[model samples]
Target: SKKYHCTYCSKGFSRPSSLRIHTYSHTGERPFECPEEGCNRKFSVQSNMRRHLRVHRGGRPAR
Candidate 1:
């Protein structure tokens, strides 16, 4: 069972940290940004930003 619930939406999470990250969806806040120069890409979660880093390192996305 989810221990934390989002006040803005129906989504729930097992951890408060996860719930906090999920709230970014409703707030439209992207805290994670690409480190590469000229790349202004942003994401709501760190994991997704980590995945995006692959494109900067490999010049292409994973298939």
Candidate 2:
């Protein structure tokens, strides 16, 4: 059972931090960004951006 519910959609999070990150999916407010020269891509989660950084290191990004 989850305590934190998303007001934007039918989703819930057991942790408040998880709920905060989930809200980005609804708000389109990506706080994490790729700082690789001209790539200039953005993401809502830091882990995704870190994984994306792997591409900069000649590594494939995991889906």
Error of 1 at 59 (Å): 6.7
Per-residue lDDT of model 1, residues 1-63, tens digit only: 998999998787999999989899899999998888999999999889888989878856533
Clashing pairs in 2: none
Model 1 residue 17 lDDT score:
95
The global C-alpha lDDT for each of the candidates, from Candidate 1 onward, is: 0.88, 0.89
State every prediction's TM-score relative to the real structure.
Answer: 0.77, 0.75
Tell me the TM-score of model 2: 0.75
lDDT for 18 (candidate 1): 93
Model 2 lDDT-worst window of ten: 54-63
| Residue 27 lDDT (model 2) | 92
